[model samples]
Target: MNCLKKTVLFTLLLLGISLSAQTVRKYSNEFMNIGVDAAAFGMANAVVASTSDVNAGYWNPAGLLKLEDNQISLMHAAYFANIASYDYAAFAMPLDKESVVAFSAIRFGVDDILNTTQLIDDQGNIDYNRISLFSTADYGFTFSYARALPLDGLNVGVNAKVIRRIIGDFASSWGFGLDAALQFETKSDWQFGVMARDITTTFNAWNINEEKFAEISGAVEGQNQELPETTEITLPKLQLGVAKKWVFHYDFSLLTEVDFNFRFAETNDVFSSSFASMTPAAGVEFGYIDLVFVRVGAGNFQNITQLDGSDSVGFQPNIGVGFKYKGIQVDYALTDIGDQSAALYSNVFSLKLDWSLFR
Candidate 1:
């Protein structure tokens, strides 16, 4: 049909725009990178290799294959001293012995932002009633599928993501992206995983409401003469991880993991270059009788240049605890402890439930 052809052409044009190097940005759609599940956050996002729950839909979908039953997860956290809210929910189920599927959603937003642009009226009179409230938000919805490979220890997965961004009535955009992941387990009990995010370069075509923007265009002279860029491109990123577990006394266990995150462009990460940058993270979890857990992690390593032209390394540290009983789990994490990094400390809590819990 003619309509279908036009749609296809439009998609191709968007892809072409995303492929252009000049249009790409390093942190476009960064809300998705904030991560979900307090347990994973507590681990400094180093669970890519050992994740095996509903939240795996966001970390590494291939781990979904380890799901033994239908599961649901929910999390809520506030950032910047409660000025912003971040929430997540997910559901996962096994399709058969060797296949699984999951769906997840995330929302990050600042609500009730005062819109003071209309405070001064055309008559040079200030009207208190002109002030209104609006919200700026970003949302991501993902569908994931995973299946076992012919190789004994190999599994593969994929994710289809839909991103939505809103800045009150002034602007809005929608984006689409894809992710691929692999997980492998060795006979020695070591687990390895690799995740390719935004594999095809996500593109968002912004729709700016010129009429609404005109209200504040002249707030600053010479700065509002032109409209903002309409296209945003998110380049690809990669993550590699490995993990292992050890048991002691037949009732206590320890799990440790390390991950390396790679970005295509130069950055101030621990390892940086003109072509790429890498940030390494490590985490450990100690479990007592498979019911109580304690976790610690460190990540987000970056080199900061001080005013004296001296550079220093900074990282974030996190700690967490969890308890599970009757197919229900509760987790809490304190992230960015001691404020060693630029980010503020946050307390995150999450809940997980198995379908059997309700039966």
Candidate 2:
């Protein structure tokens, strides 16, 4: 390998080591999003089954192994009750007859908010009123490589990504992660595989102030405080999963999978910290005429305590469907949670488009 290739592999390893500590940030404000419906993620994101399409970038870069032509995908979604949104653009091509390389950019936007607080009005009079706006955004880059091997029955792939999160007018933090998988084919009628993801990441941070905020709220610090000296939080993120399939005589197949996510973060005042709990998800996929498909799934949630000792908690159920025409396919997903005190547990909805180079 040349220097450039060596650099790529070494950086991939660094992403895997990011699992050491936990984080104090609110991942829900960033990662907890659905662009193609909750059904996609609810099922272990196993879209790698037949990768000749584009959504594979988010689900399984290994799925790229199945692609024979270039392709692109665009996805977007409305998340939670916070008026947040997510957008993604992905494209890929072959680096060689046997290998493929893919690139993608994802964005999370927290629209300006109506800040409300009490003011003195310079008249020594206190009054509650709407204040300034608040919101945040982030960016992620992924470089994935995959190939098919003729080793009897072994087919595997890996992906690495650089993730950065930024808050409104705050210092941004950079993170890296790793994802790997192996798939085995038996009689071409049955396919089985396992995958691991987000093996390393901080998930969130504790603070974003341009400078360290004095803990005493009235303490003076030296010039060293010119730049934002923020507190970084950590999160343990490891996913282990297995999937299987049943193929019909025609081009149709029925697939199912289950995966477990273990969090290493400790329960704390931070939001995403509550997700320190474990999550086990399972679902099935169905295809007809190699063009249309549908899937449904469900899973548990991580519970975190909030003020008044009340926090959001529970099991999440989801469903999704897909349609293919010419070389274009569209996907949709939905996740539902019952209700809560402060706000009724909200539902998440997403849509995704996949186009192949052959088109």
Candidate 3:
């Protein structure tokens, strides 16, 4: 096929994947799993135990209780050769000495997609003017709450999520889910956390535009004959993390963390079984007087089958840096460095501001 034909085919494939909703899809609501915050991305998403900022609203809400002041955060990243954009924003504050609350929003979208179903007229004459443009997007809004427990150094949190997904003028879906998390700190400075996502089994109900479907039905021969399934379900997943920070010379510090992500159904994770799968991730950060920071992480371990039918281990590596001053912080992360994994790499940037910055 020609380059233009290839591009069109690829675009349609993406739309098809997004519109294929089922009752129990393994990767339903996957955009939410892409994560937020350059710092977390830098660490390959191993910050659940040590995340204590506004970004924690999406990572591990229990960590929100550690916020000492009201804060706001924003992040943006581009993927798939800039064909898609991912954006995030969040606000967090202490409701009281023992409790905290946060609000977060995320969007991942592909804009200006060409709609070519009408490119050819009834006379079989191709007309470029017949093409139109549309977009496909996914949005998630989370309301998170965290509270300190009566037990010293213990915290618990919960998140209520509203999900919306749109495929231009063709199909749309709305979903809701719940997440629960816990965090604990020890006198030895060890931090531990556990997060349960989609704990209540998230569900999405899709609404397809019959007219649009009919228009495309004839565009591709013997394809899309029937309407897609209207219901999509997302199963529960878990993440466990442990971290510790050590200070030296009263002006330097290092933080190390490890995380285990588990999905109930087996796939190609580092460790897989019929019942569950696990991927291990590790990250480290070195800081000088809490002002300059450097981070490195590795994760997304998978077993890939080579062309020769041999299984090979593959993983993603990430690196990032940050600077903080006067209640403001900026962070940058390069994920999937060196294209070591099957997925594309991305450059992520994020900003954080403490309310005190205005004072």
Order of all candidates by lDDT, from best down to worst? 3, 1, 2
> Tens digit of lDDT per residue, candidate 3, span 1-359?
33354357445844474355877876789999999999998889999899999999999999999999999999999987777899999999999999999999999987777788888999999999998878789999999999999999999999999999998788889999999999999999999999999999998999889888777676777675777788999999999999999999999999999999999998999999999999999999999999999999999999999999999999999999999999999999999988579999899999999999878
Which ten residues in a row are the worst by lDDT in model 3?
Answer: 1-10
- C-alpha positional error of residue 285 in candidate 2 after TM-score superposition, expressed in Å: 2.1
| Each prediction's number of clashing residue pairs | 0, 13, 0
For all predicted structures, in order, the TM-scores are: 0.93, 0.68, 0.96
lDDT of 1 by residue, 204-228 (tens): 8788777765654654344434566
Q: Which sections of candidate 2 miss by over 4 Å? A: 1-39, 42-53, 115-131, 149-153, 198-236, 249-252, 264-278, 301-313, 337-359
TM-score of 2: 0.68
TM-score, cand. 1 vs. native? 0.93
Off by over 4 Å in 1: 1-22
Cα error, residue 2 of model 1, in Å, equals: 52
